[model samples]
Target: MSALLRDVTSAVGDVPALLAIARKAGTDAPQPGQGRTARLWELLASVAAVDVAAARILEPHFDALAILSQAGKGPGHMDGAWGVFAAEGPGSRLQAKAGDAGILLSGSKPWCSLAPQLNRAVITAYAEGGGRAAFAVDLHHPGVTCEEPAWVARGLREIPSGTVHFSDVPAEPVGGENWYFNRPGFAWGGMGVAACWLGGAVGVARDYRESLAAGAEAGREPDQIALAALGETDRILTAALQHLARVAARIDGEAGASASDAVETGRSAWSEALRVRGTAAAAVERVLSLVSLNRGPAPLAFDEPYAKRMADLALYVRQHHGMRDDAQLGKLTLEEECPW
Candidate 1:
């Protein structure tokens, strides 16, 4: 494999190992009060898995390009928001803060997926200029601190939500004011996020199948009813992933761009992506529920990996801002503000 390809595979392999350690670390070690380095690493691992898989499939036709291209929405991109807000000069933006010496920050993201072990973060803040911007901050900066949160939910707690604080920690600018949200192709990452959730669901379904097979020797017969339900769930997830893959392919290929306005093209691409993500999220929920029902009380009797996978899938799927943006879909279709 080429150097880039080798690097991606190595990174992808790190996910399972990191996840194993993070899963065992319990909910308190990465305390909410801790930095999100580890959580950030988990997100990175998740992203790496998908990108590597995509690269393997697409490499036959595309050649040497990085399958997991990092646009503004890529991993570590959120910290870019810090600079966006900071450049805004001053306001109640997501990651920006103002103090006598300069803009100071002391807030936790609470839901950073790979924060527990990440060394850097693209944080957001209000700029001294009175506009929104993002900054890429080195997590090891002395003024920066991490706090892992205590509350663990049904899913994705292995990521360990927490707060990152910056006591006048200096951060460099990543983009101009409001650029983080205004940039083109910002929505692709949303779809990418959903894809990871789908993967976790697939993992659960795989384990569940194995469990069912193991039980058969004890005379457990196949339930035709549950089989159909599981099949349907699988079909939905497959369709969603297929749709997302198509979009990613198009974007990487830059298909349909030469003939159309770039903004319009990107908007359409992302809008369709959001729809697919929502569908995938729903499909995952249904699959999880169906699996639990089929397994009876046995699945819940112990905290099997699938149980944790289900929890992670549940929380991760809902992390996107897709629902609130759905209204824009109608507007896009009508070429005017949505009447609804």
Candidate 2:
């Protein structure tokens, strides 16, 4: 409907199509091949934003959800993948009664990035019956509406983020009142957000490399310096991803056998990932900024992919709640510090 919504839908819609393309591009892909990787990448990319209407609406029926549930399989299935849609953030209110034939949902949600293309949304709402409850409602319902409220930051503007509104929209209960927050991997979902930022860094770095090749005749000394800076940033991001991957594997291993420990480990990993994400983002920004500052006219040019990547990367990576906080990093060391 809205231009932003159309853009997001187009972006998300590309997931299945891209996977198909990837499969065709690579003949040696595993059984289910490109589809699997595409799904994984799509999921991981979803973490780049808090809006994941599709994930929440579709995960229950997809095999990817089960694979993602395996925390031990490594962060590949969960960390960078499995966007946590209904897990956190501001709460909403729901109306459902025994005598009433249909469920009524009325509320507003902020920062629902995937709200546009989400045919259905798994949302948390205050239940008229008692406590909080999780519900799945079709987005196209007569009373349902989504608006791209302003407040979007630079770069990640493509997310199509905005508010979702429901005025007596029909709804069905998905999980229990506490189910959304108490879910095993709830906190870990937060850490996965870092992975998306990491991907953006990778994307930027790749572009930077290409730009360097094209500008070979420009000069060598400054180009070499930029390369070195990018290398360091890559190192930092790699370390962060490695740590996150390890924790994801550990969590999965523990998940089936012990839910409690799995949750704990997941939380720990989530906190650590946040710190790593912050550091990685900072590293990338440092290099990007250095290139622009020292290169002056040459590097500041916007047509190059790497030229404007920093701004987008910075905006995208900066969306994290805890990553924005300096104290959260300390919580990773002291287990008791996690409020949730």
lDDT of 1 by residue, 206-323 (tens): 7667776777778886678767766876787678666655545444444453434222344565566567567767777787788887777756668555555555566666655455
Clash tally for model 1 = 75
Location of the lowest summed lDDT over 10 successive residues in candidate 1: 59-68
Model 2 lDDT at residue 41: 32
Model 2, 169-246: lDDT tens digits are 776665556655554444444444455565555655555565666567566433567678657756765775565555
Clashing pairs in 2: 44-80, 44-81, 71-252, 72-252, 72-253
Candidate lDDT scores, in order, read 0.49, 0.49
The TM-score measured for candidate 1 stands at: 0.66
